[model samples]
Target: MRDPFAPDFFETPVAPEPPAPVEPVQPVPSFPHRPARSMAAAMLAAGLVVGSVAGGAVGAVLVSHRNTGTSPNAVATVAPGVGAPAASPGSFAAIYQQAKNGVVTINASTSSGGPRSFSQAEGSGIVVDTQGDILTNAHVISGANQIRVTFSDGRTTTGQVKGVDQSADLAVVKVSVSADQLHPLPLGNSDSLQVGDTALAIGSPFGLQGSFTAGIISGLNRGTTAPNGRALTGMIQTDAPINPGNSGGALLDGRGQLIGVNDSIQSPVEGNVGVGFAIPVNRAASLLPSLEKGVAIQHPWLGISGQTLTASTADQLGLSEKSGVLVVQVVPGGPSAKAGLRADGQASANDDVITAIDGHSITTIEELTQYLDTKNVGDRVTLSVTRNGQHISIGVTLGNFQAQPSATP
Candidate 1:
């Protein structure tokens, strides 16, 4: 090591010459733009995977909220009125041009419980307002210590988390960017979205900036677990390719309106395999005011963990039909528990099976929760269930579902 205290150390050192300026490689949204996964260092991992035991467990990428916290709520779903009339998409270039600048890249540095240590994760976001507020998925910025939003023109700035609804997988992040830099995407009616409707996703997948993917609405009214295992109902399903870094990106309709926030992709390889999921923009729009005001969003809970019965599982139990969710466990003092609903205490063949709710047939946990979405807390619901081979109706007042820190991933 050189001795800095020496008298000769006072001499000035010559500065090195600056490198030549290189042309910036601008990412064109109209063309394919996906960066290899290796470039996106430390991408966050998603928890939920879709599959049966037979096909071998495949890992899809809808991340769970790692933070141990509480958020509870009425029916499982929350939204405003249905969307507007479907518009045709003959202008792909026009749609991309209109929304491109609004799309941004988010770099979140989160603490991993170690001192002076952090992990970097990337996700996509949209400018939701002129005040510098941006909308992104809750999990993308969850537990982040610092957030940076990079715009299409190569501008980056610090961000702050305004509010988060883990149950709904939605969040608002406010940045210090200039007002002129913000171009809020227009909110579209997700309820008006139909199967086969044109859908496009714009995000920074695999750290590739301004990447866009196109597809059609694959399904609707689908139920999936949120970051904390609370049910999210009426989700927009699409075949648009989404990857690890695509979380919090936009899912637009044919008319160039923001219809959903891309969140999950169902694939055996943790890559896009044609099936993906988004949080309906209508639901997100309905909660934006609350989120901007820094209020925690809530959803209804049933107080029980259920297993959607499958044909194989039903055959193992000798059931004539595998239609209903099997109650595995019920929260004590919960609404269901207070109403005398039973669970399969010992994995017995005679577990309490919910056959219907308010006369609506429920074959899967998704169906049961989807129906509850239309209901509210303190509402009385009649559940038709089979207990010990006997059909009976149980009236239970609904209770809010609480978030568990240890909700097993």
Candidate 2:
């Protein structure tokens, strides 16, 4: 199977033959102008694939690829009337009109060694403030040499990468433009989002600028992997039609508030199948302060891979705890290893089963990851473990996460 999150290259277009005689059909609306065939062919020849996933995990790909409160020193602002119960759901047209100006087209290019030879990638972005800070997916601008941002009014300007957090697949880009040219969207509370809530997506899918789609929130707290091979937890799943060139776009609520960032989709084919995921706006908001300053964000890491301890497995291993994470392997020199955490070796009975972290019960890997995300590097956390019928707490100082290389071809 092909890697689901692999970035697709623009293929050379073939000339169409004359159409057969048939009944006349209604005229279709025209789309934005695309790159010339010659330029597309050059990009294909360069073999550049943006937003490619690094692992063999299947069922997800980057669609290529915010809350309205004025976070202090942040680019995003809260909508005027978010968080309060709506009298009734507003129309999508109203939401579109309110958010269209904040959506933008991002064109990123990377040099391919030869003089003036480059490969280009296109995605979308959301304007956060008048200071020109726009939020987008890290994969959209990953390894890019030149970045161009186009506003809804058809004006294009150069963009600079302010900061990026690959572990979360989020980035901040800055452009120098007049205050009138920017329309900052209001940020909403993703925590306030419920399953079946209306979701509206606006972006440049398939290079069609100003495209819009609507759906409902399908699920929440979904787990997936980032482009950098790190686990992304607490994702918002939606039935919105997210597709190529939709990455880094805005996922808004019915009130025209920014709720999530369109990230990836789980589909058997290389297109949207009503299963899409978005990074919670709160996650981006948490990193905005550091992102605006061009500081590299470091995620707290616990270097161990494990499976959930089940009744059968626990019984077979003669373990007492039936619900917890079973430590399968611990990376050498990692925080867990340095803290003397034990994992299963040749003997399964000697394995350590983690039951809780900092007094909170953890029954599965997702719970553990969710807890870790709330922490920072160098923060000491206590892990309650059951080892060989003995319960003990181990103090481990968390470490920075290092991105694993992509295994996608």
> What is the per-residue lDDT of model 1 for residues 1-409, given as tens digits with 9 covering 90 to 100?
0001111111111212322322332322221112321111101111232330000011122222221112121123435785644423335555777788988987777676898665566678877766666778776777788788889887888889987877676777888766678777766777788898888888876555666678889998765556665666677788777766677888887667788888776555434567778878766666776776677655566788777878788788766557788887777778888989887654446678888999998888878877776777778899998887789999998876687532210
User: Candidate 2: misplaced stretches above 4 Å?
Assistant: 1-89, 115-117, 312-319, 344-350, 405-409
Off by over 4 Å in 1: 1-90, 112-116, 310-312, 319-322, 345-347, 404-409
Per-residue error at 183 for model 1, in Å? 1.0
The TM-score values for the models, in the order shown, are 0.74, 0.76
- What is the model-wide C-alpha lDDT for candidate 2? 0.70
